[model samples]
Target: MTDQLSQLKQLTTVVADTGDFASIAQYQPEDATTNPSLILKTIEQSQYQHLATEALQFAASTLANGTQAQRIALAADKLAVLIGHQLMQQVPGYVSTEVDARLSFNSMATIEKAHQLLDLYQQQGADTSRVLIKVAATWEGIQAARVLEQQGIRCNLTLIFSFAQARASAEASAFLISPFVGRILDWYKKQQPDADFSGAQDPGVQFVRKVYQYFKQHRYPTIVMGASFRNTEEIRQLAGCDRLTISPNLLAELADSHQPVIRQLHADVPFIEVPGALTEAEFRWQMLEDPMATDKLLEGIRQFAADQQKLEELLKAV
Candidate 1:
């Protein structure tokens, strides 16, 4: 147990990136996170199918005297909160439940959805402090997070890729930030396979390091969570980050290995300094200039939005 716990601690803070309570219990990650996509995947598994039915039943009961649209919306919120509750039961740390991805671009709608998720969790006897509302790192989403954070609801800024998103999320004083390492590697691998990321020169490694450095340099309290890992190499490169939310498969891979994990990032090292605080215009310009970040951000949102719609259709069928 010491060896396992040491390995888990030496690397980034291990966060179980699944909706399955059993897996989370087995590993005992410090935290857990779920998105619409993860919830959708979990419901397809035979073992987890009960969660969906439970959600549907709860929604049905709540909406017994309400309209169809109201019932569906309430059902979605109930499902997310119930899943969050199950995860909290397995892990002692915080559990993240995302707002509907379709509301990512609408500040008011996103805020309303976030409140609905929180309300449902409270009704289930869960503490709001242990629940982080996950939202995409869109401009509007960041704004919504700003408002949510002010209202005392911690927010986890998800789908973050580039420095701009990280900067904006930190500026908003979000509770946590999940920057995708695997997706960034996927993009760069296709475009520059010959580029060496194994060394300190890896672009993906450099990107995350930069974000971590910025947060530390600015003394921002937002936690950096490296996510969406494709391979151990990316994870290895990001060792020493504040946190890393790894998939169950990757966690298994890390657990089975005995290779040495080194500390790659530290607070003492001086980070590259950027110009003074960026205005919204400057942030937008930088994101626009980086075509890759711009394209990937929009693409990620579109994919999540589509998956969200698909999940809604499934709920309606139920």
Candidate 2:
């Protein structure tokens, strides 16, 4: 009998959500996703620091003619691109590299930073189609994605927690959206005393399911990629999602287990009302109305920013 992981792969594209390329190669996921936090964690203990050192040296040589601070920023961005380039060589599909989280709310800055990362890839002769510039799902970020999409720059709108965020991303015609599963489950569990949620009723599972149904009903081209699973059950619940970006730890568990797996989500279900585009004010108000979305989005950005800084500090120290 095939393990659950192999069976799940037959139903949906399995993306390894980590910066550790060795394990990524071990699983041979269709694609691989990386975030500020994962990159920081991986590079700290990974044998891949040589890649960062080489990128920093390249920045110092050809990337000269910038202020000291500007030089540091260039080095950091180069590190991210180099990492993405290496991972792209490993996976069959795209590798996601996130924009600076501090620019999460700034559309213009995010747009500029995004192309800058692509330019690095362009210079190295890496295929742009194998890259996804990850942006926070802020209204400004989604607007940034809209412009980038027009220029043929694909985007992965991430840190999503609510239907509003997902809807806005799809309206912007993003390449994909990563709705967090563990974080949503954490919020609801924190609120209730007994925390009885489980199976399909799990808040995180239900949230993604609702978004999946909404997209299927609308027939939107934007793909839904479930992310941040706290346990294997969440992964099992979302078996037939468009994609799932899973951690290496959970991937190892799925690789070992032969548990029964089945498609839990089907896009051909009864169609629901499709929501149209959201105005800037409407998007902000919707986030304000949903405390869980607001808190989780804020926390997610802060955590990413902090980890990026830590990665920067580590790079600088070397």
Candidate 3:
């Protein structure tokens, strides 16, 4: 009997949501993703210290007269790209490298940072096509993605929590959107502590299912890559999604399980109402109405930004 992980691969593309090279190698996922938190965690390990050292050295030599902040920022970017380039060696598909979460609402800044990341990748003799610049799915970030996509830079619009955000990302023609599943479940569980939120009744699972159906109904080309799963059940529920980025623990669970995995999502679902393009006001309003999404989006950005700051501080010390 094939493990659940292998069976999942038959229906959906499995992406490793980690920065650890060992985990990527162990799972043999087609693609990998990295964020401020993941990169910081991976770099703290002894085995990956050298990447940080190299990044610091590059920052020192390149920004000889730069301020401490500038040097730290460059080193952080270099570190992320170095990690991504290494990941590229392990996976045959794209490696997601996120821009500074602090620039989440700065469209031009996000685009500029993306170019810098790509340039660093190119300097390493990496194929830029194998890179996905991850941006928060803020309105500004979507605008940034629109510009980046026009320039042939594939983007992964992340921090998605609402349908408005997902639709806007697709309208921008982003290469992919990572709508978090486990995070949604977390919010609902907090609100309804005693609710029987198991199986198909899981809000996170239901949210992704709805988004997947909408995307397919509209024939949108943006890939809906479900991310941030908390358990294997959430993973199992979204089996046939366009792609799923799983953390090392969940990947291991799936790899160890022998239970039969069946496809739960499909592109042929009945079409839901397709509201025309969402205006900026309408988008903001939607987010405002959904307190869960608003809370999670803000919380996710703050967390990522905090991790980014921590990563920079580590680079400064090095």
Candidate 4:
């Protein structure tokens, strides 16, 4: 019998959700994703320090007249692309590089940063076509992604927690959307400490199931990638999703087990019709109504931004 990891791959595209090249090689996922947190975690290793050094060199040469803050920001961007470029070599499919989280609400700045990252990837001889610029699924972020998509750059809308965010992302023609699984479960667990949840009953698992059904029923082109899983059960429950981005620990767990992996989600599931494309007001209202979604989205952004700042500080010290 094949390991659960191998079995799951036959049903869904597996994606490694880390910046470490060694893990990417070992898991052999078709695609991989990285954000400020992952990148910060990876570069702390001594072997990966050269990427930081190289990023600083690139920044200094390119932004000689810019301020120290400007140089640090450029270095941060370069470092992310450098890590992504390396990851691209390990994966056969897309590698997602994120826009600065602080710019999540600035549509124009987000677009500009996306262009900058692509340009850096091009200069590094990385295949631009295989790269997906990751943007937060804020209304501004979605609008920026809409523009970038029109200009032929694909985007991965990250930190999605609501159906409204999903609908807006699809309506914007985003290439992909990552709805976090573990984080949703985290919020629910905090709310009900005494309650135990697992398998299909997991709130995070249920959330992705709904989004997958909506996308499939509506025949939206945007891909639904379940991410930030807490355990293999969350991953197992979301089997047959468009894609699943998993951390190395969970991937290792799946590889060790020969448990039967069943196809739990399918495109034929019953769907709830959301009226139409979400307006900014409607999007904001929906976010307001779902406290879990609202809390998680804000926390995700702040955590990413904090890690991004840490990455910059790391680069400055190098």
- Highest-TM-score candidate: 3
State the displacement of the C-alpha of residue 256, model 4, in Å, after optimal TM-score superposition. Answer: 0.3
- TM-score for every candidate vs. truth? 0.93, 0.97, 0.98, 0.97
lDDT of 1 by residue, 19-106 (tens): 8777787778999999888888877777876766787788888779888777777776787888899888888889999988788789
lDDT of 4 by residue, 273-305 (tens): 646678899989999999999999999999999
RMSD to the true structure for each prediction, in A, is 2.2, 1.3, 1.1, 1.3
Off by over 4 Å in 3: 269-275
Candidate 3: tens digits of C-alpha lDDT, residues 18-125: 999999999999999999999999999999999999999999899999998998899999999999999999999999999999999999999999999999999999
Question: Weakest 10 consecutive residues, lDDT, candidate 1?
Answer: 1-10
Q: How many residue pairs clash in model 2?
A: 0
Deviation in angstroms for 291 in model 4? Answer: 0.8
Judging by lDDT, tell me the better candidate of 1 and 4: 4
For model 1, the stretches where C-alpha displacement exceeds 4 angstroms are: 1-5, 65-67, 269-276
At residue 182, candidate 1 shows an lDDT of 73
Query: What TM-score quantifies how close candidate 3 is to the native fold?
Result: 0.98
Question: Lowest lDDT 10-mer window, candidate 4?
Answer: 267-276
Model 3, position 263, has a per-residue lDDT of 95
